[model samples]
Target: MRQATLDAMDEVKRSLDGIEAARARLASRPSSLGGRGLDGVFTRYLDHGSKQLTWLRGTLGSATALAGVASEVGDSGMELGILQMTGPRLQAAMFGTLLLATWVDFLQLADALLRDCPTCGSEKLFADLHRVQSRMTPTLADLASGDSERIEAAATAMPVLMGELTHEFDTIRREARSAMEVGGKVMVAAQVMELLALISTLNMSLPRPPPAASTTLGMGLVMSSGGVIAGSRLVVSAEWVEMMRRLVQAGVISLPAVSAAVRIHGGQVMMAQANQDLPEGVREALGDSPEVRGMKVTGKAGAGMAEAPRHHVMPKEHREWFERRGFKGDMDIDQFCVRLEQSHHEAIHGGANWKLGRTWPREWNQMIMQLLGKSGRETGRALTRNEILNIVAENMKLYDIPMKFTKGRRR
Candidate 1:
């Protein structure tokens, strides 16, 4: 088996050489060969096809062998499944490892493609930021429209928004693997489960930009909080999501700012789609988050709390009752809502306004279009509206009472 593995590995090497040669030969050839007037580069994807084929074969063989072992172990009645197998336990472990290993191999290749210029094989980042950006150089001006800018901004911000989650996952990988004993393993296991949820929530949180604006209008709330990586955009990066999962699970960041807790049920956005205008600093503090875009407007679902009463007191009835005497039955929930579900959501949010509010006023919803700007003025991060919202919402709780339904219903 070892020799076979080695032989397969060797074959891959030979194939890689052939691919390089094909590319080199194509370089000397003219544009007829699809070099597109370029040297040492293939004008088309076919140029590197042979090497890819080789890599795939070797990868498949190793992955298959490991996966089989994993399945057998999974069939066993073990306490826990892991890779250090002498028996069934080993099998399950191998399966999990193989999956991650396969993903890693792909990651390396994809990273190379993005980081190294495909045409010149140069390390000088020709495509890493956003693949969309590299393709849009039309050399012709006045041919573009506002739509193009909006599209570019969104596509560019996708990965940048996934920033914190990236670091969280890195920490998880390091710490989770190091926990070997029962207590340590248990801790890591629980954390892994929670982190997994955080990761999923983050993904769902920023899957796409709102339909209204070409730019990220809804994500204003997320960016203003500084969760945004400086040069990136709305697209969530895998690395960033993973990091956030790890951090929250491990208790690194208590009360992690996960995706807003709106559930989609029966074709309806369950929570109020909503907010009211705060001062400029408050707005800035909200960040360019897609979630809180147009904090001065109303909600999509017509259920925002900001449109409720503005008085510092609770619901009129509740307050009157309190002023006169106490209630007869249990009115904690109802009473609290009176304090929270008010005009501008301020009746509830007055003390907690610093947090990225989950709810908004009616009018602010329309102003969402002006949320996050369309550009990343830095060199390393991109600004996605959702990310900005998460940042702002998370930070806001500091000044308030941390009123999340979980985060004080900032759900």
Candidate 2:
């Protein structure tokens, strides 16, 4: 009868081993490419454990009642030796029932550990498992309340049950740690990929480039398009404005990151267009030149602010043009401004004019005069202030540029 009871306990342990393996698979399957929607497996397995435990508990209760009845019949001289014969078996059944409850608690803990993760609510689950472990590994003194024979039976069962529980506890801890370790990195990578995907969508739909114009002619065209032409071209290129609205509605990427990305990309696009229109000679000269010139201008004073010598730039109106599109997130305001100045110079004249001091060059003034004459209705003279202003306004309107006009002669 002892051997038979031991065999039954071994069978129960084997069943538990299978259940543990299934639970581990259930937790990991969602991470696999082919198993994305297989999470239903966990729910189904939990339900199965619940049903089995209910049946097992009822069976154990019935066996206990039968044991009591058999003991009474023996006292009445029925000559039925069931109590004496089934002593070890009855002990085994009671101990096994307790182990089964522990197993169910463990299953519940595992389910909780796997479900709320990356969100990381495993503390409660771990607490419950610790309580079960304490119960399973109780001291021998606790069983001393029964007769010496019952104490011996508990001693025999306790070690086996504790060994099984210990093994399961180790398995859960290791599996949970591994799952969480990989889960965090996977979540971040997935989000970054999504943002990149949206950026690609924007790039794919960019409008075809406008017809190629001469360095001088393109400058006039850009200026004439309106202060906004450069920016407007960017607007239609990607349909990013609409994309941003949708992204904001969806609430995927952080608003700050999105804003920074849009600004950086727009600035880069404008720089590319400016580079394209540059004269080959100027572009070549800049590639070979290493000298950097500093330009300075005074800041307008406010109540508590002192006037400072700010770095000046050529085609002064363009400083504002770059600012409207925004700056790179990684760089400081000064560095961003420096890059803008460099790009603006390369766009207009094909290279940095380090040889020229802070003052606006005569050549730049001549070019502006020429642009005014070309765009104006009249011929033969550098355009007057009113004529230049009117022409710039008309060009900005026609070409959709986003820059504002400055009447200052130095710009």
Candidate 3:
């Protein structure tokens, strides 16, 4: 996980470099419209991308820290068995698992942001803008001539083109900002989790009744040694002991509640990981068998026929949409698909006997398209891979589609 976080950080830094280069190229372009043309829009676009990349880098750094801490805790033997133990150690283990879960969430979100928003770090947008500007150069040059008719025509045409470009820029910026906003919220939530963990650890580490009893013993000695002065000190010591006792009592009472909540949350996180349609890190971590090579293509596993037909989680019909959102290569989309039993696959797509209008308004594929369309309309961008898989998982559950591979696996 730490390595993954570091890799994401490196990717974000590379994107920052690309944004910087794009900005430099935009800067080199002569501004014939005096900062009100494509130059201005492209500059803002690159600047926004740069800012998002910097923010992502910082978030990944925090994730790296959490990942490191979780790793250390895991190495110290805080596995599932730790939950059965008592005392501060169990509290510590619970917190560690919570942090680990939080780190996993951050990693998934960061990976999704990188995949879904290529413009967040790439120079492709700037390159496209430059190409558009190059195409308009001849017309722009005509504006320099003293012909009133040509100047008027150019003036009339340029703003329309500029307006269209500005609209496109605004749309992309909004989408990028939306994606970054989600990341920011996740980071804030992780910080809150850390704060809670710290409080829980401190509560558990309090000296308990021993320190307060010791203070009382000291008060007795002081009172016996001196008269009025000793009495005054004794009163102060009593108050201190009382406060300590109250704090310890509060810790004793509250610790169990906090532990229970964290345990419940941890369970939810594990469940979510299990429900993912794609077998990525989650499957490996849970000790599932390795994916069969060429299983997706031949639909066969070794010498035996595969257990089920392969289902494309993202739907192969909309391959172009996924391709546009960074699943570009030929086999890239295939990686997202999973194999399911023939019955499960049919059920997901609406079983053979199921009719369109009489049964339901949409099948699983149509439902996915609706989800994608709704998300795109809301965010002004395509859904990220994580987001798409999440929708797939949720719909599978809604339809009671049993996962063939994960049916008997321990979550």
Most TM-score-accurate candidate = 3
Candidate 2, after superposition: displacement of residue 319 in Å?
99
Q: 193, model 3: CA deviation in Å?
A: 61
The residue-by-residue lDDT of candidate 3 on 283-309, one tens digit each, is: 222222333111111112531435656
- lDDT per residue, candidate 1, 1-411, as tens digits? 222222323433454444445445434544423322332332233223333334334433443443343343322211011111111111112122222222222222323222222232222222221232222222111112112222222222222322322333334333433432223455545554344434332333333333453233323322323343212433333333344333223222111112211111001111122233422322333233443343332332333543433222122333333333332122111212222444335423333462544253411221221232222334235544223333323322432322221101211
Candidate 2 lDDT (Cα, 0 to 1): 0.35
What are the clash counts of all predictions, listed in order? 84, 16, 0
Which one wins by TM-score: 1 or 2?
A: 2
Off by over 4 Å in 2: 1-39, 67-80, 85-89, 119-161, 178-411
Model 1 gets an lDDT of 0.29
Candidate 1 vs 3: which has more TM-score: 3
For each candidate in the order shown, give its overall lDDT on alpha carbons.
0.29, 0.35, 0.37
User: Tell me, what's the RMSD of every candidate?
Assistant: 27.1, 37.7, 27.4
Off by over 4 Å in 1: 1-40, 43-53, 73-411
Cα lDDT of model 2 by residue, 13-116, tens digit: 55445554554554454433332222453454345444444544444344344334434331221112222222333333334444544455455445535443
**lDDT score for candidate 3 against the true structure:** 0.37
Error of 2 at 205 (Å): 63
